[model samples]
Target: MKKNNSFTIRKLTLLIPGIVVAILTLQSCQEDETTELTRDEEIAITENATFSEDVSDEDIEIANSAEIEAGIQEPASRESSSEKCYATTWDAATRILTIDFGEGCVGPYGRQRRGKIIVSYGEEGNYYVADRTITFDNYFVNGNQITGELYVEKAVINEEGFYENNYTVNYTILFNGGTTFTLNGSRKREWIAGVLDDNFANNVFRITGSLTGISTRGISWSHQIVEPIIADFNCRSEGNFLYTQGIKEISYSNSRRKRTRTVDYGDGICDRSYTIAINNDLITITAE
Candidate 1:
């Protein structure tokens, strides 16, 4: 075959599908054909590279596990497929994450702010990319003075590989430490977190559970709205915010508003109740 060894990458962008096919055929024939490569062929193959050089074990794992592949061709061996790295972590499964701003982040001024922080992960292949989502939640204005506790509510890796979280997000701004916000209903990022930062108005971040769907992350504004990680836990016994074991009824209290959180986990089984207190925007749901 008179191989036109010269190929512009951009042009090969379309030619790749065909090239991949040819390469697959050659690789299968390698058992009979000598693995030795002519100097020119080796150089051409290296020059026409498209994938990342530093392919990791995860990349190999996904590609090898593509049993339900689009094209019905027998998958090439991992050693052979290692070089053609056209893989990603984008999957169909949705991940749910609940971010919490710790105690230090919710003292006097910090506690005054209220709302929700939606976290999400883009799926690649059949599984969710765990390490791919390593974002810094810009907390320290000076990288010294802290803010609050960014608690993680839920992060489960499903069969198809995606993290899923479903929760209610608040978008109310309280001026004083004794102010209040409301979780009356569901609202988009535009209506809720938008007031804080214009970017939050779009579907950039995602809320795991609330029927409204996921949202995007945005800049936090003080005047318009303040975002806070809401935690209404089921208190096993009482007073134990950091639950260990045998817990009982739930309790929570947001700083600004004295709102009642109807935390009915299911069908009247764990359908318990509790009184809430809005001390400084912290919804301390004390158990009865």
Candidate 2:
């Protein structure tokens, strides 16, 4: 999708002031020798949230398509093939939509997936104006099992004529090695662009709010989006999808003490590099 001119301008304006502050902040701090949360734990927490966001959006897209196909709404754009790797069924009586990725199928980013995503809509039975609850049935993505449900309240159009909703996620990922990652929180999502398109690659969303979870290694953490995050579906890093741009404040706590950090996803670049600031310590990560 072409860049939205107004949004692009606003984002660039933010970079001007942010760059100066970042430089000053970095120059003033000396790197710390140790961190409360291990590098792996930090990465796992972020990755788990990214995975949940991707899956939640995918479920919404599929349900939107099902609504169009069922004549409940007009087509947004051409039907997307992202979910074509699976079988989808709609039960009008129950207001439930199911997308089944039998045995296994390759999904976005070439991740192997299986099982079913069952979505139920509210009385309106509409994708745009009704609430949606999505649950998984023995779902596994790339050998990691996903459990729990994602609840999305009905959309409310903002003054700018864009749809906004509150998304509550109670999710867990159990890795093949038996380690687990879990997230339980709510975030506000705004459809900033591409609402008329069925293809997700053209979509862009802005997210705000906080999430608290346990990383794969059992570290307790809380993350708050200090700067609204831009999840650009058009951008992916090394086959692992992530929020293209944003700033978030993350806090790690255990029995002894708490450590707070700031993470920046960068200036809307589609690269793997991101910066983390923990007190006097500065770390740059380029996902491998």
Candidate 3:
């Protein structure tokens, strides 16, 4: 009986190791099956996905704004023969309008500036002015300069005869100190009544826009014009735009650093100056 018990003990010891090995093998198979199932599920989702359906209204708005803003800087056309300052040429193949500012060109705010602006048009012909892509190569205003590209897309005249051209735009501005600003948003331009009739007195234009900009120094800003900026066609002044209710938010370092500001355009006083309030501190900035 003792011998029988010894044999049984040996058998039991051998069976225990086999059981453990089987259990480990089963666990490994189960883990592999789970991994395969997850991979298959991911593949199925990708195959069934449609990118267009996933696009939101906000995404569409941003894209449209980028396009319209790209074309906003077209030099105003003059009707007077003597005041025909910018020499214009058109390229039919590229649908590009080239405007050259001759020598002694004086722009708004008494700035002596000279440069060539190239404007490319889109295929759509619904509006009097088509969507355009404007490129400023070394374009200067006063002592400061603008050298970059802008895209104006989906520009359409307000059918209600408001003289407002609504569009979206995207732009990049490389400013001083190796600083660059990028913007994408929507804007509207309202030319003074009868301005298109070749009246220079009616050359004034108003701009209302909402824009989001990012700076090269990791800073970001978003602004919406509460009041339209009244800009003279002769580049005389730019102001009278308030963003009091629109709110301007600036952020840095992935939004960990942030500040909110509101713009006040001097109570209908067009001084070409505006005030920005940040944390209740008002800072004034004059247009250059």
TM-scores of all candidate predictions against the true structure: 0.16, 0.78, 0.56
Ordered list by TM-score, greatest first: 2, 3, 1
Better of 1 and 2 by TM-score: 2
**lDDT values for all models:** 0.24, 0.74, 0.46
RMSD of 2: 18.3
Q: Write the per-residue lDDT of candidate 3 for residues 44-144, one digit (tens) a residue.
A: 22111111101111122222222223343233342332233455666657766666665548632234546766667787641235666666656554333
Worst window of 10 by summed lDDT in candidate 1: 48-57
How many clashes does the backbone of model 1 have? 59
Name model 2 segments beyond 4 Å from true: 1-36, 62-72, 81-83, 236-240, 279-281, 286-288
List, residue by residue over 1-288, the lDDT tens digit for candidate 2: 786999989998989898999987665442221354666656556656556656656555555555565455655445654435677787879988887889998865456879988888889747868898988999898888889998989999999888999989888878889988888899988989877775656777888999888877667888899999887766641354456788988887665556677888788877667778755777777642
Candidate 3, run of 10 with poorest lDDT? 48-57
In model 3, state the lDDT of residue 147: 50
Best-to-worst order by lDDT is: 2, 3, 1
lDDT of 1 by residue, 1-288 (tens): 665656655677888899999999877666323333322322222111100100111111222233113231132221222122122232234542323232223211112112222234334322122322221233221112221221222335445443433222332212133322222122111112111221111111222122111111111111111232112122211222211111112112122221222221222122233222222332323221
